[model samples]
Target: MFKLLLRRFFSLTLPLALICAAGFGLDWSALALADQAPPGAQIFELHCAGCHIHGGNIVRRNKTLKLKALQRNGMDNLTAISEIVLNGKGNMSAYQDRLTEAEIQSVAAYVLEQAEQGWK
Candidate 1:
């Protein structure tokens, strides 16, 4: 009986522990600890939420992050949005220095995604 129980424990608990460790239960590597880039939503919250809460632009109400507004303003695509984010336009300040290229792209993609989803 003890032998059977021990075999069950090894087969089940050991594999579960290993799986959990692989899934962050024991991830202490420097690569894991290295600063991972914040997601688009987080970036938006930190840098744009103050001015563009819920995709509504307080500075330029007409130029919101909404899909319709983006389309109407010739910013319906990722390239256009990325350009604005990289260089800024009108009331918006450039984020070229504040964010890495990847981050800018991520934020741009996030904006497009949120816009497509109606910012809900």
Candidate 2:
């Protein structure tokens, strides 16, 4: 009876300990780095330029939201941009499901950089 109880306790506790360790490892990985844009500008062209003109698509109806405009609107920072992409505003759709969190962070960084440097 003693051996059986000890075996059962070890079996349950070992799995629980392993599970807790795995969860901590995953959480650390998730928090490891600040999201940055990918190496190329394709993400901006494909996902952002439709409504924002600085990346090069011509504006049709919506206001030409370039880096300058974003700055003027007080949204020319990476964090703001990321939040906007993830949560969306007005006619824009949330991109949390479409793009990875890292991708969104990268694009936001790119846009903020351009805004700060005057889009030259």
The best candidate by lDDT is 1
RMSD to native, candidate 1: 11.7
lDDT of each: 0.90, 0.70
lDDT of 1 at 23: 93
By TM-score, the best candidate is: 1
Residue pairs in candidate 1 whose N, alpha carbon or C atoms collide under 3 angstroms: none
In candidate 1, which residue ranges exceed 4 Å CA deviation? 1-38
What stretches of model 2 exceed 4 Å from their correct place? 1-40, 55-68
Q: What's the TM for model 1?
A: 0.68
lDDT of 2 at 55: 44
Each model's Cα RMSD:
11.7, 12.4
TM-scores for all candidates: the values are 0.68, 0.55
**In candidate 2, what are the lDDT values of residues 1-120, reduced to their tens digit?**
999999999999999997998986766554444234353245776888676656433544433346666766567677888898889876667999989988888777877766666656
Error of 1 at 40 (Å): 0.6
